[model samples]
Target: MTPPLALDIDGTLTTPSGRIDPRVFELLPDWDAPVVFATGKAFPYPVALAHFLGRPEFVIAENGGVAYVDGETAVLGDPTAPRAVVEAFRERGGEVGWGDGDTVNRWRETEVALSLDADEALLREVAAAADGDVTVVDTGYAYHVKSPAASKGKALERVADALGIATEAFVAIGDSENDASTFAVAGESYAVANADATAREAADVVLDEAYMDGTETVLAALRERGE
Candidate 1:
């Protein structure tokens, strides 16, 4: 059976500055398998990254709250909180804005990329002001506020359902706090050398080297799996 693979963009497939490694780019066209771009980035960001990775047919973006299949966007469940929830969070003296892929992310002439944890007092205050059901995940960059039900694992399940494959057929790779759940649930998982301690703990394998080499490592793993 051919294995299905999912790749994270930022620190896995690309450099810290977001450039795709040329050597890895050369290998992508020769790669075989149903590869998915599972990233915390938004639509266009991941799309650009996937284009670099050989235009994968399926993508799980916005931390798995949003999915793009054959170029169509399918929002599975509520990835973002309701307007009221956002309002309540703001009421608690916390500044909330749209992040990375947030279509509604319009703030200070810059695209909102989520929230930063400035102080524990502020974190508690924002958590309290929001609807009790909000899911606040640490994405290394910021506090990702979403519905408790939205996650990369759930998004992977959707892709599996669409492909008529079991969850065990998937391999997930990532390198940050946001990738924890995705890594935790995948049949096989890998963490890049640049991954933080939290990401390393959740992964089955810690990549032996940094970003560019990590892509090569992942491709090697895929080839071994007969992808």
Candidate 2:
């Protein structure tokens, strides 16, 4: 059987400037196997992408804080620790820098996503101080303050469980550190050419193409292998 696929958005499916690559509209909707969007982005982002692309809405969002599979929803992460961490950061004069509107985090449910420009050291210290349950992850695009328990690997496990699939049967593709956990759970994992050190190190294969081009390359390979 063709493997179920887990895909990361942002740096994986987007151009360097953060626009969705047009080819996704053509290929993803018709992919033979299941497609799961695994992203550190808020719940809506991946779900919305699946809607627009006409792919399966099976999604692992907020870095595993939330998931949607087979028309059911699961929320697994705690928002308290992340909120406390952010509050402490603000007290320490650290700014999240998404500006007043802060749409990036306004809708987030389980974690705090800060700009890459945020002070990592400060965020870590705050996370450690408030609750050891929360950990800090640098996704290359942003810093995530969340529970380690709520991660892509864990969410994938739940998805697999829900669908009677094996946790080790997925093929994952991504381009940053946020993808590392998913890589660990997958049967085969690919890091796009522009992947950060963590993702490249975790993946079984590092593709030559970058960004959406790399995603297309992997999809093409899957098609050929499926044939």
TM-score to native of every candidate shown: 0.79, 0.95
lDDT of all predictions: 0.68, 0.89
| Clashing residue pairs in candidate 1 (N, C-alpha, C atoms within 3 angstroms) | 99-112, 99-113
Q: What is the TM-score (0 to 1) of candidate 1?
A: 0.79
Alpha-carbon runs more than 4 Å astray in model 2: none
lDDT of 1 by residue, 61-138 (tens): 777777777656677645334344545556766565444555534311111235564343555456566656565556
Candidate 2 similarity to native, TM-score: 0.95
Clashes of 2: 0
| Candidate 1: residue 186 Cα off by (Å) | 2.1
Query: How well is each residue in 1-227 modelled by candidate 2, as lDDT tens digits?
Result: 46789999888988989898888888888887788999999888988899988877899999999999999999999998788889989999998979889989988899999998888888788888865778888887789889877989889999988878887888999998889989999999999999999999999999999999998998887888888
Best by lDDT: 2
Give the lowest summed-lDDT range of ten residues in model 1: 104-113
Q: Scored by Cα lDDT, where does model 1 land?
A: 0.68
